[model samples]
Target chain A: MKSASPLPVVFAAFFRAGLRAKRTRVFILLALVPLLLTLLVRVVDPKESGDFFTKVMLSLYFQLLVPVLALFFGSSIVNDELDGKTLVYLTTVPVRRRAVLLGKYLAALLLAALLVAGGFLLCFLVAAFGRLGEAAAWGELGVFLGAALLALFCYSALFTALGAFMKKSILAGIFFVFGWESVVQYFPGVTQKFTVIHWIKSLLPIPPGEGGFLIFQLQPSPPLPSVLVPLAAGALFLWLAVLIFERKEYILSDNA
Target chain B: MSTVLRAEKLSKWYGNILGISDINLEVAGGITGLLGPNGAGKSTFLKIAAGQLKPKIGRLTVFGEPVWGNPGLFRRVGFCPEHDSAYNEMSGGAFILLLARLHGFAGAEATERTDKALAAVGLLESRGRAIKAYSFGMRQRLRLASAILHEPEMLLLDEPLRGVDPLWRIRIMQLIKDYGRQGRTVIVSSHILSEIEAMTSEIVLIHQGKIFAKGDIHSIRGLIDSHPHQVSIRCPQPRRLAGQLVAGEFVSGIEFAADGGGLTVRTDQRDRFFSALMPLAAQAGNEITEITSPDDNLQAVFDYLIGK
Candidate 1:
């Protein structure tokens, strides 16, 4: 019998399963928080809606939602299987470990993307309601979506690699998201570039002072390099996740 | 018969605690029962053979190739783990179909194989139900279905009959016996002597962290059956039962209960004593309430075997 490619098979199965997952439902609610805030701001102060949207996008979507969503979803790609003691089923199959990890990673990445995108679209439509005819408003929305996608990719890949390397990666991922990304993005000069958010922020159209408290003393890099760094970093992290998954022998339970 | 699995000086330990130590063994194409008490390294040995674990020392191989880090070997191998785990969110059919596709079956073939496997385990009727909705025995049958979906040449089952009802237990035992009849290699592990005895005769005894013995079941049964047995019989007339039992050649000693309702009988030959006790209980005026064999446990058998 001819062997089918395991990557697509695993990806399709997990993707469908992921959509119905309770965690996905939770993430959908998390993504909607920004849109809810956007709607509230538009109602209270119509003229200041644009500024409110920008700050919300930066603070909630970019700074919080994207990375946090990526962290939970990506880390669960392998960690959930281990905790549930279901890794044996996947690993015992004839398919390669890399195929299993990569397939599950793709499902997580797509799921996280959908959550972020759905919420961002709603927020954009509401925030840009009056400026719907303006082409520039649509362009700005495009930039935000692109930046969100890149952020999700980089953070998800990094967390996926961390998940494969260690069992309790979520706590460490929380530290990385809240502690490192939160504080380091505001650091001065080259030190700020050490954070993933810095590169993600560089892709945004917002100027230094316009981002309010979340964007203090910001220095954005060139758009081209900003895009390239995250893309390259995401690819590297994904490759690392696959490497660790393929070679590492995960002890599914306490040695019996 | 060809050796399908071989372990050479294999030793595995979790830090200070040992799993299996210096074990040299070979298993051929037949149903070989791994008999041991809990925590006796039976699961550890099966895990290594199933490629779920790596040996800390020496080596373990299946089909003349190393098991660890070898995914391709699974094409010919099926492993039913001891743990009760499954994708609770997925239906039983979906889980088995997913594994079938992973094993390289496509489209109709996958569905057909999955249906056949589920039917074999008598789970076809509940295949559409979510795993979490199923009872423990159903989940166990699902696990067994997942292993047999592809009809691999070798199967490693760790306590497969656990949580199963008596009716299904007999059916599963017959199914495993059928697999052995097909000349396939099957290694089944269980803590219960009779559970293993009911499946196949070829047995391997493990204790602590080492293989105690490996041979046919009768040899081990001989050692176990000969062990001193203590049977506590509760009857309305204790003195009558004890007086009758004392004359039997198999009776080593007898002690009557202080309450005068029962007596604990120590016998060298339990089969003979039980055969003699049945007639006495059936006789008029002698009422037997309960007959309990406290020393018939696997631990006692192991203790006697190891001590001997």
Candidate 2:
């Protein structure tokens, strides 16, 4: 008998399970941090709310919160199965391993996207409160949302690949987020462009020298590379993840 | 009978420790028990057959196809892993239904198959409960339900009755027997000899990562029965019991405990020895507090069989 495509099957089941997971609950609360901070800023300094949103809030969302969320969600796409000893059910089915990995990847991507976008929208509405009528205000929100998604996509895919390749991948992911990405993104010249945040920060609407406090020595690349680089890098990372998952053997239990 | 599974020089190891050695085996359609003690490579062999781990050297095949990296083979295969694992957040029904859908059963058919599998495993009534709420036995049954949900041709169950209650144990054993009676293949692993003996006469005794013996249970039992067994009897009057028991031809030797309250008897005929000890214990003032066979486990039996 021809089997149902396991991609949708796995995606649907994991998505439903993800909704009730403790991590999702924690992330829901984490996503609300920026919204709560935006509310605080709106009440304190009504005049410079938009300025704070573009400079400080954008840096907070793109540089810190987005990457951290992506790291947790993406690495867990494969790591959770291993730790839980539940990979047997999926692998023993009549579906390809690629389908299993991709299905989980898609589910995690969607869940993280919702968390980031939901919080960003609420924060934007409060920060750009009176200017909601202006098209430019909504357009700026659109740009920030797009950049946040690209960052999630790229970071999540990279972490997914990292997870598929190693048993204990969270440590490497922590190092990448805090040690490599944090330090390398500020390096001068082409070295700074090597980091994922560089492309993401370039897509923001904040003008140079204006956001020096949040993003010091920021050199925004051209719009085309900023968009294409993350997209291409995300695709490459996802492909690598699938490749590793399909070929590599995972020893679930200690040998007897 | 045609062979349903085959392995040629199959071997696996973790670092320096061996899993299963360079062994060869073939199994046809019927119940074949993989009997061994803990860390005797039973799980390793099953994991390799189930495609959970790749063979470090050699190969394994099911239905005439390599099991590793071959997902299509699972269409005709079902594996109930030994690990106590499931999607704890999902209800039992949802867990089976997910596997049903993945197996190509859609909508009504998937639900129907899920219920049928659960019912067969006696979990149908508790289908709506989350797996985390299920007892260990119930979770074991849920894993069984997941394996048989698709009704595949071959079933590989590793320690299926490990944590089950006595009633469910009998039922699960009967279920495996019934499945084998359908002319399908079933490979059940267990460390308990009686458990394997109850399911099928055919068994493969694995010890120290090698196939020690593979044949009818009666033949294996005969070999084990011939090995002199040490039966330890605890009593207040060890001298009286020893005096009465030392004359039997089956009794090879006797050793007094250092504590002076017990004696260990070596006998080739365990059945005869036990029958004789019953009368001794029944006599007035010859009270037997406890009786135990120190070397009755599979490991000791294996050690004897290997000439240790």
Candidate 3:
């Protein structure tokens, strides 16, 4: 039976499952990825903490850990069921497949948000430690955190859509992360706009005229376009997730 | 009896393999045994009826509504799938409660329903532990509990008794019969003939993706009884046994095994053949050690029916 409004139930199920995850322990080490870079920057040149902070956020959070974390959480929303053979419980229930996809997608988004948010906050504290109550410092932190959240939502939704569409979406997601998003975000002109990280990097407080390996190498789109495109595209991707999940006929056993 | 399920030209196939071929059937309210050998399209038929799979050729309706992808029909239906699966992370109690809540039961009533189902299946004591910690038999019973917890009107059980203990098996069978008494429909599938026989008389025999027969067990039994019966008798005095057995009018053919080992008799009238064998063997110096029916299995009966 097709259930009415099954998304909430699916979300709650995934939320509970995520809470029970032992991966929270692993997340501590992951959160340290950005923190470790900050520690290295302070020991080398304590005066250039802000410059190093932007570099650290781009290299660690945006380039590596953010997308990696989103991939793990989002892909597992559907992949966990297919792998564990536990999707039968949800599929057999009269709930709409959209609700199942969205609910689990929300759960993955929240977990990814929590992980990135925690890491983002810690990196800020370490970078600007003892630079208390500076409006400019806090403003830059807000932009960075906001960009990270938007990036997480967009990338995680993309991965979740990939998961709903295919069983072997993990390999594809890894390729997108290492091959596409990582490589394309650095390309000059409009090509960088094609990557989620490009828009994310645009929203950062780094001025366009700044000279660095990232700035001189990659010319980003305007900040407004960067933010709106991924957001709009994320919603579209999420919609496609619901569409595919609702229509897909997932066979639980070896069909006779 | 009211018709609980109706299928019209229902068929399903996966790739080159036929899951279940063209089938038209009506099931009235009671325990209806769906008997078939392994890979005989039993699970496929059940999945279609339970709304798990779509029909490739025709239609299947549970209580008049098309079952596939229809969640509203779930209010009246409960399906216990053949696959050994459960949310292993949730405790037995939590799993039952989740289904009950899904059915819109409130806090106290949901708890009551969950408790009743667990107690009914004798899993109340293990309610606190995770399902993954459960034994295979307990998980099977837990699956049953989840199905019944919502008090669904039509229960579809695919191999419900697999890996169940004898005592619980009897209890579950009784519970099914009780549901039937309440006028709810229950369709149970199993390879075990005696298991199906004990639950209810009405049955649907499926063989190799086709409906071989659909009727009561006795009616099917009559078919087997009417078939040329083969009885083997291993005795010390084979000549004496054959002498008494061949004299009967029902005994059409008889042969003694090589080395004068045992007697094999084919007869149209099994009752008369047995009745004649008893008296002749009872006489002085008549020694009978073993007797067996190799054709007692449903498959053998089905094969005979098809061959005929």
Candidate 4:
């Protein structure tokens, strides 16, 4: 028997929905926040801006903005379907539920990436002003973007998994962002490596030729494990998200 | 006829709440009205049949194959949900066309079908409008368009006529009737008895998720007829009218109004009593001013049937 693929259909449906969604505007604003801060840092102190770029901007991007974006974008992917009760269209189709989840996940990830990466590029431009020819400047920007993308994938997948498995996932997502990730990423020793932000901060090029802090006190991790851990963890979380979304039955309304 | 849909002792529950219980039914092609008051298992049963939910007990099948999680079956089945929800961002035409394409139509065929469906539902002119801008009735019609655009053999419509204007209501009803006449299966649900009566004689009366009655309308009427109906009439000659009505074989009892202007007549035969009352009121000497039935109210009728 011939089976239809659901991925493209789900992707298209979400893409069209996201285009006209009011929330996209808010996401755009969120993506611009980092650039605004970077601009402020640059304007206030033009020449002595290296420390601000390495410590403050890096801390803000890795420790704060990325996970918050992931939390909002990922959770909304499933929660939106439940809220609008539009999930019936996808659920009733001949497609497996996993296809529906994964498709929506891809769309959400893409949208989040555009916002985060777009913001990161703008901030990178401001932070690296007048350093166009320097290898260190371009390298810093590349590493920051790479780390931000990985953080988005890992955090979004974790939250997406939570969304698939729970109804009030937003509350749990908030706690994970503010309570767990914020607190866990700061713990000293190997335990800090368990948090996604640790891997992200480890890959940055700033605070170069480091002692403990980069340029100031921004510590970087060993390169390979930093890259590999978040990637593997993200894939694992994404797999869990697909599994739960496929199996869980979501009741949008009270039945007779 | 081959049983296109079947359920055997099917039951579903949510925690301590009963979603639907002990439903056994078999249906084939043509229109079948699932009639019940609000909160009756009509929506639940249809949702399960549409493969939106799983039955906790027994089984449900369409085309002799189990329906849950079966996407292949959707090629032949379409559903219009009761809730008024759509991709409000998309243009109405795009929504319908999207569904048509999902059903595997290609190129010009999908566009043709989408146009035909919009035209059928009186939405062709508003096809370019965002669904959010459409009125409730227009949205209702849009939902209908989506369901029919795929040209599924079986369409499950939950309150498909809801929020629709009268003319469109009749037209939409006719469209559904026409689908049935074409040998396609349609299960339409509504809380209004007369609405279902007007759509199809074949009905399944569901109450609290249980299939209470399933057969021709006359059979269900027979079950209800045994429960006497109270018809109140106000006229200048109230006592005189009551005297005349009590003699009928259908009238089980009659009571003259204490206000001296009406009479309440109880009859086990609603049709026969109405048939006789028409001519009696038209007689030259008849001075009947008003006629009403407390039992004619749907809630009272439902209560009487449940033997409350």
lDDT of 1 by residue, A1-256 (tens): 6566899888988999999899999888888888888889899998878888887666788888899999999999999998999999998899889999999989999999888888988998898899999999999989989999999999999999999999999999999999999988878879998899999888888887767668545668999999999999999999999999988877776756
Q: Write model 3 residue lDDT over B1-308, tens digit each, in one string.
A: 76789999999988888999999999988889998877789999998887778899999988888987787788788888877777778888987877776665656887898999999999999999999999888999998987888788999999888877555777899999999889899999987665688799999999999999888789767666777767676777788777877667898878888878778888787667666766665566765644534435446667888887
RMSD per candidate (Å) reads: 5.9, 6.1, 8.7, 7.4
User: DockQ of each model against the real complex?
Assistant: 0.58, 0.58, 0.16, 0.30
Clashing pairs in 3: A1-B70, A1-B71, A2-B70, A2-B71, A3-A94, A3-A95, A7-A99
Question: What would the per-residue lDDT of candidate 2 be over residues A95-193, giving only the tens digit for each residue?
Answer: 889988999988999999999999999999999999999999899889989999999999999999999999889899999999998898888889989
Q: Which stretches of candidate 2 lie over 4 Å from their true place?
A: A1-3, B226-296
How do these models rank on TM-score, best leading? 1, 2, 4, 3
Whole-model alpha-carbon lDDT for candidate 3: 0.79
TM-score of 3: 0.82
Query: Which docking category, incorrect, acceptable, medium or high, applies to candidate 2?
Result: medium
lDDT tens digits, residues B87-107, model 4? 888899888877776677767
How does candidate 4 score on lDDT?
0.80
User: Residue A170 CA error for candidate 1 (Å)?
Assistant: 0.6
Q: Which stretches of candidate 4 lie over 4 Å from their true place?
A: A1-5, A208-220, B222-297
Identify the leading candidate in terms of lDDT: 2
Instruction: Give the worst 10-residue stretch by lDDT in candidate 3 chain B.
Output: B289-298
- lDDT-best of 2 and 3: 2
Deviation of model 1 at A52, angstroms: 0.8
Candidate 1 structure quality by residue, lDDT tens digits, B1-308: 99999999999988888899999999999899998877789999998998888898999999999998899999999999988999999999999999999999998898999999999999899989999999988999999998888999999999898777655877899999999999999999988766688789999999887999999988767788888777777788988888888898999888988998989988778778877987897777776755555424566879889988
